[model samples]
Target: MFTPSYHDGVIQHLITDVSEDDFNVAVGGQVEIIGWLYQYYNTEPKDRAFKKKKYLESDIPAVTQLFTPDWIVKYMVENSLGRYWIDVLQAKEDPRSSREIAEDFGWQYFMPEAEQSDQISVQTNADSLSQADIEDVTLIDAAMGSGHILIYAFEVFMQIYEREGYSRRDAAKLIVQKNIYGLDIDTRAFQLAYFSLMMKARGANRRFLTLDIRPNVFDVPESGELTSADFQELLQSEDEAKQLDYLLDQFRYGNEYGSLIQLDKSVDWSMITRISNQELDEGQLSLSSIVLTESQDKLREICAVGKILSRQFTIGAMNPPYMGSGKMDSILGKYVKKHFPNSKSDLFAVFMERLRSLTDTNGYYAMITQHAWMFLSSFEKLRSVLKADTLINMAHLGTRAFEEIGGEVVQSTTFVFKHQTIANYIGTYERLVNFDSQQKKEQAYLAAVKNTDVDYLYRTNQANFAKIPGMPIAYWASANLIHDFEVGTRMDELVDAKVGLQTGDNSKFLRIWYEVDNKKISFRSVNLSESVKSQKKWFPCNKGGAYRKWFGNYDYVINWKNDGHEIKNFNWPNGKQRSVVRNPSYYFREAITWSDITSGSFSLRYREPGSIHDHKGMSAFSKDHELLIMILAILNTPVGDHIFKILNPTVSLEVGNFKSFPVIKNKTIEDKSFNISRKLVQYCKEDWNTFETSWDFTSHPLLTHIADDNLSHCRSPVG
Candidate 1:
């Protein structure tokens, strides 16, 4: 018997208040309300609830669940599923025309270069498959958080069936029974998904519910299915543990071959059908459920659910969860590392591997996930694995891709990669960056879908990527530039690259220029350069400040009087050091420093003697001052910034990324570079001293000169 417990038990509560005219609208509204409630409960204090759990373990699904917007769902479904159907239809014709192509796919065909390829319509020989063969195509949403993607895919499958002369009612039933599959780790999500899919069928035929509809949706593992007694019994028996492991292996194999085999009497349903109570007492294992009944009915239901998920999909779509391995529990982290070492940096990366494996040959896998894998050094191995497949298209959206999420959320990118490794395939990459808001980001995304000519869009071969030092998806690099990376020497070879000290507690040990008691921020009752009678507390510190170049960002003083004893002893509540002090020997040494975080290019500034640099600005020290200035000149150039963008795409300027900078080791070139850099620094210093903000300045340059047309065009802001 089919145990459809979720639809009647949990789903009814979710859609109770959702009474709208349109089906999609009603579902969307319910989801919005559900999401809002989840957010509220997740953020609220649990202490006020009278010693309840600080946060319910069950609420994790709601807290993390992000609704896939309607437009994005359509974009994903159409490109993966819709494109498949279009290719099939095109194959039925003897000769395909641009006009027919324009009429049929003009709205979706954005890549003009790919449009020119005659093979664009010829995805596979299977395109000429009969209607019956097309019906066998399986599509799954691996993460299926409320079944939004699967629901839209249901509508598309209905259209395909309808085109093959099936009525809407029959099409809906067939689509649910054969075409769609969904899996989610969250039971609440599975419940919503099941309810939403059932409602989709109900929308077509009111009498559809009266007939049995086995919607191919299952909650992964169904943690609540087995009782504590059942688990304890299994734990006690080594034979039962081995049997369970074998069952899991069979389940995995079934996913790959389930659809290929017919589910008939030839298969042994005996394990599911026949269960004896004696086996439990005798320490023998069987599929009988301890919680439900000692019969095959419950076992059969679980087996059926397992049968659905054990099949591979022709098309997969999802917005997988965005969590990193660092946030996972130790057990989960260990399992992920062991299973998915190549993509273990983040949960989404692991899903990318899982989704790809779930797809059959020539199948399309499309997802919107954190974009870090494309460029981060840690994910280089994962990128290599992706390079083995065919990249269909990508929409790389920078930070603030999601609404109401800011400050330091992972940036997002939407991409579709096929399981095939076609060498000549050219993928379209639309780089949508610097959008002011989530609304603008969506608008920009839709523009890409419709094939509007916009900036930051390019079409490149997959072979061009993952070839550089850090394996950056250098979609923006020219042919000449890519060649340069292959032959260039890295910067760390020339200079001694080192990050500065981390004071641990800046407020206690450091103070701004204004916060100091004297002209400088001074510690009370402390002596400076010479030894003090009382104590020594204040010292000039070179913490990285604003982005002005050569001379003036000296804005703080640090208390390193006793060799940073207080900071070194400080510990956080987590038992970790509150502050990290590295390379203390390099303190008060002349070096070139730059802000670790900046809005624009990484600006290298010079630091004078008697100043300790902080972690905010990493310092590059050289015994030779001329060599340091040369490195500074190289870093300040547009070429240096362009390379930095390739090494580390994000705003963070890590020493690791800086170490990869290509340097020229020729003495002649170094001398010339040093001379030019010295002149530039002198000019910047002169400009700095001219301003009243400079400690040495007497008057402002603008006050000394009368205003003119030249001054009007280049006016500076007044305080």
Candidate 2:
């Protein structure tokens, strides 16, 4: 009835120009198609947002859009929503476990709890809770990107309602109107979710498209030019006025904050819904009653959003955005820092806490987030909060969990947790980190599920994580390893691991040894004062280089002339000093240093006296030189490699990581280690001296004596 010719021509062009296959996919009746469409549609914007040196708050949806794989969606929904119904049934009459019931319901992705032995430390009361009426059970996805999770949840809810004596058609409509709820900040994401949910319901009920059933999915809208005074004239009570005011102020940034906005849980949204939609008789007709009756006004939008955020869900699931605090703009960073202080390190972590709070007590929250929070020290407080909840299951997808994003930069883990704590609850975990691709990871997870004794599957009590320093979720660690953490001497007690300086402008103050005047460089300065006394412009520096062990990576020289006056005085226009001189006394103290942000095995190399280190090249020192070598030797062992990865599985390792490393004081082993370390260092140094990249390099071994092997001793290998 209302059509504009100009927009109609654009629509005609869209219909005529697009490929038939694309149109077929739109009508494919598969909800997953929407996620794929969104993935490809926002390709350019996502790339642009990521590639820009400077990003804006507007680019959050673009950069964080990830099309969750169908298998992962099934896994998340089958475990959370499916488990909810299963638990309900199990708690009522059926003696079957939640996993067994899920199997009977044909939830293929639901993993059975691993077999725990009698020798286990503690027991749990996992099945002693009551569930809400199946009709009242609801699932909400706060970060419902393209509604992938919500669609799968709809399928689960439909199955539950159907088995509970309702017809498929009625179940579909009920699932849309009552069961599945979703919220997203981005307009495009919200639109896709709305359309996807309708299509999903339409598949189960053929005539659903002609019906007036509205899915409980709303796009978060900002409250623009909205004020409490606008509704004050109609509000009958002061509490209503305050509620309206709170809604307005909370939703001012609703478009940016979305479901993270903590709404007044005390507000009766169901009562508000009834009052707003009630048919007004002639006698009951009044301005105050019409205050919340405006369907198309900002009040309605605010009320709709408030209704979703005001109540906790029986099951909350999402694949929240994965942006580090470093990438966030000041507005988002500070807001998260202020509210979700414990999980302020990343967007996913922040949303984790948000979702947990939005879940009902004794309910469940399921999500797939970057695995950094599972181990990073920055999330210590978050881990502490999680200690109160019981972990149900986990699928550790280390990397390549998403088809769009590749490499080790964004490792992911999917998990489901009960909102209540269960003492010594044994959580099942699928270790898919070794599986390189999505297909391999999925297959590995299923394989681990099928075989209880599979090497990839691990069952552990979450309380054991707290026994270690920083409380890393090292599910694969042995009981002995955990005990070692409690009994063994911490590495911090054995040696002083110090983070070195930041020259700020490495290009200005640093150079390859070959890039500087040889006469101006000092190879041996015992202290910072000696550098100024010797009048050398450049001193050997240990800015972390590529992975190497025992010795070498000594290729750069730093300008430390006159006690680094030029570097220390380097400042911005705001008079903020650019350089950071940390642990200045340890500059030339002969420590073992390791490179930061490494992808390979952890390796600590020996650094000789007279050289300073960089922030990336963290240094560990001991007053006894032999003891330092022994410590380096022990830290470089295969045992150390395993322990270190458990400590901080992410790429970045720092001084703090080493401080928690478990060490035992065994004199015999220490002496043997010291001798072995001494020999290894000598051999590594000799080999390093022959390499062209090494500062000690004199000449190539081939050029030393290739002409006459019998007389090779004459050149002394020139190393």
Candidate 3:
């Protein structure tokens, strides 16, 4: 018997004189010790020491009050029991069973001890196995949290045994003690596993005291008496001190220590012996720290379990923790790298390694994990590895699977892998479907295959699986004709002249232009182009209003003039000296249009809307002006839409205010009614031809030509 202390929001400790009933009462209510342990393990640490720290609960005392949701347990039991368990353990099965026949006929097989026996027996038909034989198949939930899957498996096994003429009580007891095995990082979950199995065994036989007899098959003491002293002893060793120092150094350099450790001192030594004593007496305590320590220790324990299963059982199942790379601390990262290098590279990668290590060459492994590893670039290496090793029978469950956890609307997929010679499973083909709140949307366009040929099938509803081909891609011209021209030109030949100017103080100058009243615009305006009338209007800020004062103090004004002469005229303020000017300047700005073809590299102009025209013989007035209008009009037409579709397809083109070209029905050419100018016609025809050829679109060339021609000619004035 023990007296329990409930303080500090926890059951701190239990004094002597507490009964087993009291122990169960103290730790087995709705607010049980396991629930408290889970709450503690999951609670976010406020201080730096445990801010991002993760703790496991295996080290704490066993308390069977924790249980996983029943539905999940049922699913795991149905899908991962019998041969599934044997597959996990790599054990051999009877040759006369359906498993052997199934394996021979291209179905996935699971058999434990196949390798050790050097012989495998596979069943091909489901009806071949008798209820007695089915009951002989043993299973284990290697990392059973709260006994969900384990208990579910036990119930299933009991059903098979009862159908074989065995009494429910006898069969259930056998199922609990001999048929099912469970391990967990949380001692509370382990206890739950133990109790849940017992509860399942008792079933409707709860009234029989003989059936309620306690089994000693699985016993995890209240305080973890067996491991507490050993762990504490390990903590006191000089080797542990050295290891701690190494770990601390690694953490410091790796930038992980600030949140994992509080001080250099060792763990509380006095607590170990006390914890052990409490365990023997079935004492009660908060057990948070102990649980965390045990959880960490379970990483090794899980590995040990893997080793044991490799030699013992045939089938196994687990819902392993889903941890992202962002959560890995330096110490854990180091441990993962040292122990599980392949998994250390990526989360999914580690899972693959663990699965391969645990399952036999002829076994199956299945799990539900983050789907990002399927398509994200960071996991490409892991993907390559998985593709090389096994075929995946996958079903993607969209966002709804985790809606309660505040999880993102991300896609998740389940992968089922069987180690066999067959290339594929012989069931229904799988498809991807989005489970919306009320209905499901089929995402058939996203389907793809690896090495196997997949048939495309469609389903009108979510109940069935169907395959669909990849979506059709639409491509078009990505840039203006200027881009086509510049693709092969030299830099010197392309650029004609260059100018350099500074705002003196860009921030201050911009402030004067932006922060001042509307009237100040006249003062801040500077003459940048020729013509006194143009200059006066251009530098409207200096002409008269409040803004005139803002520009009055400027030392110089920079302006350019087209003198209609060999050398264009550039003027600087009277007091200022000119900067260095070059002959055959390296860059010049010119207007361009849809009709005037240019190099593809000129796509850069799509952003700036100005090009450095290098054609030597074209008339500047005729070409530049027409180019400007045509460019602006083309930008408004579907031709421009096509261009944008090709270059920046992901970006929406509906942004910003811009001038548009109106649709003109017809334009007369000579005596005939031609829809557009001859030049515009040719340009439109060429643009359409380019789009058709580029995208491999099958359309009437003439119609596409006419539509583009009419579209190009339609133009509206730019403000």
| Candidate achieving the largest lDDT | 2
TM-score of 2: 0.90
* Candidate 1 least-lDDT 10 residues: 253-262
Off by over 4 Å in 1: 1-56, 86-132, 221-241, 245-311, 406-410, 434-455, 513-542, 561-563, 569-579, 663-676, 683-719
- Per-residue lDDT of candidate 2, residues 287-311 (tens digit): 7555534532666677788877878
The residue-level lDDT of candidate 2 at 414 comes to: 97
Root-mean-square deviation per candidate:
8.5, 5.0, 18.5
Please provide TM-scores, in order, for all candidate models, with all chains considered together.
0.76, 0.90, 0.41
TM-score of 1: 0.76
What ordering of candidates by lDDT runs from best to worst? 2, 1, 3
Candidate 2 Cα RMSD after full superposition onto the native fold (Å): 5.0
Which residue pairs show backbone clashes in model 1?
A: 254-310, 255-310, 255-311, 504-579, 516-521
Off by over 4 Å in 3: 1-73, 82-136, 204-312, 345-349, 384-392, 407-410, 424-432, 437-719
Best by TM-score: 2
Error of 1 at 630 (Å): 2.7
Task: Name the weakest run of 10 consecutive residues (lDDT summed) in model 2.
Answer: 120-129
State how far residue 38 of model 1 sits from its true place (Å): 7.6
